[model samples]
Target chain A: MTRRSISLLGVLAASWWIAAPTGWTHRLDECLQAMRVNVATDRLTLDLDLTPGASVAGQVLALLDLDADGEISATESVDYARRLLRDVAVTLDGRGLSLHVVSADASPLAHLKSGDGRLRIRAHAGWDALGTGTHVLDLTNRHLPSISVYLVNATKPADPALLLGRQVRNPHQSEYRLEFTITRQDATDPSPP
Target chain B: MAVWLWASLLGVVPVLRAAESAAVRVTQAADAFVRTLNESQRRGVQFEFNDAAQRTRWSNLPVSMAKRAGLRLGDLTAEQRAAAMNLLRAALSERGYEKILGIVQSDEVLRRQGNSTVPFGQDEFFISFMGKPSVSAPWMLQFGGHHLALNLTMAGDQGVLTPSLIAVQPAMFEWNGKTVRPMGRETDKALALVQSLDATQRKAAVLAFEMRDLALGPGHDGETIAPEGVQVATFSAAQRQLLLELVAEWSGIIHDAAAQRKLKEIESKLDQTWFAWSGPLEAGKAYFRVQGPTLIIEYAPQRLGGDVTMHIHSMVRDPTNDYGKQFLP
Candidate 1:
């Protein structure tokens, strides 16, 4: 995208990480994390996108290349994939449930100065047999320690209502709690998703 | 209760003038550092104290997470670096300055460890000023980066250095010729003090669960937690002395005179101090807290990655006077 296209986003000057305790952080280095709850497949797709500054590109590389070699291997990708599992928390109602990664994969981070700001990692996750109704979903995400705000978005039967509370809860890091209720649009019709 | 809290925190309110008299040296040093900067650099180095966002915008986080301002040390020339250090020297004790350097050195070690590709070098830290420096007026010197933050607030001659966090990732490393542990003294002294507790004191002091992190950190200014631990009244005289020394280590982060002023204030209400602990009594993976009418200190061992006790985070704050509120309206 051209600088004009970037300007169209309505963000003047530079952007800040919305999730920061002080709400002060640059946009380029921040990773965009969104969660989409699916009624069609009883699954959630977690997408994490990062465009690191030249200074922070190396950290993304290290996460991809656990062995520190120039090239990323399948095993290293799997390792990075597993790390995502540990960082995110998904719960139905108030009860915490383990989320099984349906599939884990990553594309290599681009050049540090690349204004393209390509997607760093895309993860597709599924939770089977989730009943459909007006049920509450609480998302507690801790995937990126380097990230201040998770920028969590939840959508299911409809673009569900969301409530969020953020704090520096664990160690010196920030944790975000996003609570929302997803209702099957056709509540009159009982459905199993 | 409010009087005791303020008395413990702003004890230096009375001695502010005395400290200010000695602190003439610091104000002069700050002026000298300012002279070294050009117009553009000066604009970058200072902010109004009331920019509540800017005043609290500091963390033990990387540049990606924690945004900082002012002249970065990495970009400074040798002359400029010396000037900056000179200003810091005026603000911190001879040893306190070394501790800051030590924390910086540990960052370099973590960078070499190469856990992530992000920049974690000593140069990542930033320095900025809150308001202009005047002997009688209120101003603050805010400096920090990964694993370290120093907030020194000045009024008259009195100063409060609470609400600063000093921490390290590798916590232990080999620096220069010797093995360096930046947080060693705090860990060691705290451990010794807890061990010295007798059975009765231990029962009162130890909490049931582990304290995972600091209850009061950045953006948590002006908050308080109920004291839960063995009261200072329960300790013997020598044990009390040990406790005072531990508190001194945290307060001593500032220059000798300022640290002394703060320490003496805390000592006056020494009987009101409380010591608390959580997690296993074993040396590693434990959390400890010290609370009094005016002071709050916390040390938590983080379980980042596979290493449970390898990384440490700690903070010191004055609930009543964070960011020099005791000196302000």
Candidate 2:
């Protein structure tokens, strides 16, 4: 995968998947939305693992099994993923970044009903290669705020050219602010001034 | 490569006899290993007991895929390397030590395959310690590489082997002109337990979908799910015994004293323990978890590569005390 392409999501997922920790404890009647952010020289990726507890699984399933088929088909899984992303906002250096789905995996409906299934989605947004300097990225997830608990953190950047700084999060963790710096080592790489 | 050969040739001399407490033997062995290291290597292998970053720095992937922090076995001299293995031998049972060697050997096989983009071999393994060796205090012994991570915590007479990963890329390979399957017992026992279930039991024990990966694998520290599958409280006498035997494959990897303590603790929670299965009953095609209040073990077969049977990933964790957090306070 090249730096300019969205396919970087797949490559990043394989490498960062093992490091994605679910440090949040799931509640009995709420949804736990755990997000792991990965920053690269040219893109930022997020892996979301949405798990609904037993009491609220029906509510989540109602939104996922739109057709009431009792099963989540491949198309339904992707559609639900897209719908979920609608409530997510990402901004890089005050500029809005567009997000695209790289992959979505829905656990079996039975597993969800048991309150242990994890609906995993990997999304990414690419940008021009960062120049040597500090940048701020803000992300917010307003999905199911009434019954949702959030956990979010940025992984140590996989690319040596990008250095991650302090992370700021709202009490609920629905709002995440990250600071990162582009190293001078990448200064020679051609990019927009 | 020389380190592996050296350890194997010497058979990792045991540092202390069974008369000593498991923690005492482990602490002595750790001290011996550190004494063998040069100043630079000693600095590389020692960390503060509270260094959470280094404590949890472990994975089942190749070094290129997931970097490890410790004294790389390959960098040590033959005597230093043998001392390292001896520390592990002191901490783990005789069989446990062999299993670790088998996992290392399996990685050597993967390296010979020359198919993987990432590096693999006995030389890729590492060993480190969190806190100075002391039989009366808390400390951790961390060792691992591709397909294996053994994080053992010693506190007084207690030893906790939770939060360890035991996996194999080539589940079966040749060693010393003999066939070796590092996790063969884990696979066979799980399958046997699942197959022994009656139709009604199967309905309770089996999941409706395939599990492609571990639910509580590396990096998943504080998170734990509600217990599912069939609880052992409902098991018949014979079936219950089978379950305990299966659970031993994970808990028994520690020294005899600690392994006995863990097994007894698990047995006391029989009513709370649950065994869940996914995929077919055939070996290499199944995924199973033995979860309880204190322990969670997941065995998952990788779909990558041509045969899923050849690649496996499994994790063991103690929900109440991973990385021996409970031992601290």
Candidate 3:
């Protein structure tokens, strides 16, 4: 291994010495793939917080560092985020939604190797105003499933008119289904979507 | 109780000093604090304005885990300790000062319990400064230890209190015959707002999943998560009034004038604000957040110490102006 890579390995080992007692953190050996889904009146947002375990940091880094120069550039970061999102499936009422990258950031290689870094990707899909009525939204994650552990949650809607119902997740949390109803003020509002 | 009596005797209970702006009061109090310290103590607490690392060194952890950059309050003489509190009183509102004192005294309670391996209590708290105390030049006052951190940045008449952590252990305790809860108002106000929501509103207000801790607390600065929960625009006028009052529990912690300005900024963007909660209404052990275009406030009852409500962590940050970065060069 290169000296830089060796230094990272040392940092990763040292990270295990300190136990952080704050927030939602994954210190286990599996890669943590957590997603927060927000459904609004006009748009759908998916915020992903992906962190690779110390033992598997090398594999994750290789996937992010396209040029393998030991660093992830801005362009490379965006490209990797887009590539990951391709495996994600977001659907509303069985209609597949097209998501565009809103923001993407890859943490420094050293930080990632030490298990403290997170690759945050935010993707959004905007559509014409949804018709007022009950709707079903389904999300599936197929990104690095073999080595990844998944956590998916749907946020409370931003519009008070949008009432959320029970959420169902698969055993592995790779598949999530959300039920919601949009209550508009008047019958003149758009028909059931 | 003795500390409160001492503060009263010192005549520095955040009463208005005629014609003095908040910034002037803060700077004068800071200078006076420095004057009371010895040369070594001064060196220990002072830092250059551009010391970025020192500015972010404040943490809600024990001193052993996080080496803070300042003179420990425990190490100071009684006179110096009072001076330090006077500086805090000058920088915070009267209620804010009381809350902070309550948090510090809570640590002393922990020390009395003597269960932990590491040190705990008021003596572990530190007060540090970045840049000279000046009403014109930008400077920062950093104070924190165990479950509390106050980072106030000031310039001229402007002051920003962001990226601060307010937490307590034994969230409720008896102090001189009275029950003291440092974060009590924040808890009660939020519970009131959540309970006031109707069925449909509550359905939209609470999260679909559990949120055991803060989403944007310390170490997660400058990040704006997608706003979740019921929008403030949907609230009735009475409900909106309660929401504004809830927001004040955090924003109003700063000195009066600055707190008012901050509240006004928040109110102007009321249409964009969102309140999200996770956990049952009756159970006080819940996580709630008030997020807006400029403000993010999170309160969570930590799961340690058996009773969740006994250990709590709450954070307030202005995404646009944490550490007063907007005004700095």
TM-scores for the candidates:
0.62, 0.64, 0.67
List the lowest-lDDT window of 10 residues for candidate 3 chain B.
B11-20
DockQ each: 0.03, 0.03, 0.06
> Each candidate: RMSD to true structure?
15.6, 19.2, 11.3
Which number leads on DockQ?
3
* Model 3 residue A191 CA deviation in Å: 36
Clashing residue pairs for model 1: A19-A149, A58-B117, A59-B117, A59-B118, B16-B157, B16-B158, B20-B157, B163-B316, B163-B317
Write candidate 3's Cα lDDT for B1-329 as tens digits: 99877766886444333214777888889989999988998999999988978877866666655568799998999999999999999999999999999999998887777645657888999999888889888898999987888999887778889989988886889999999988888788888999999988898898766665566655666555556789888999898889999899889888998897799999999999999987778445888989998899988776532567778888999989999998887
Can you rank all candidates by DockQ, best first?
3, 1, 2
What's the true lDDT of residue A164 in model 2? 73
lDDT of 1 by residue, B1-329 (tens): 88766865977455554466557978898898888888888898899977777777777667655567777888777777788888888888877887788888988886766645567777787788888977778888887887778888887677788789888777778887898877777787887888999999998898654455565655446545446678989899888888888887788988877788688888888888889987777665788889997899988786443344657888999877787888986
Model 2 C-alpha lDDT per residue in residues A1-193, reported as the tens digit of each score: 5665657786677666334221111134678787878777778788889988767899889989999988998888888888999999999999999888888898889878756576888898889877888999999999999988776756545455676775666666788888888887454322111
Candidate 2 lDDT score at position B70:
89
Can you write out model 2's per-residue Cα lDDT over B25-102, one digit (the tens) per residue? 788889899889889999999999989889878876567645799899899999999999999999998888888899
Per-residue error at A160 for model 1, in Å? 42
**DockQ for candidate 2:** 0.03
Flag regions of model 3 displaced more than 4 Å. Answer: A1-193, B1-20
lDDT, candidate 3, residue B99? 92
Residue range A1-193, candidate 3, lDDT tens digits: 9999999988876674333232211243567787777777677888888878667788888889979998988888888899898999989989999888888898888767756567988898776677888888998899898878776766655466877775766766788898878788332322112
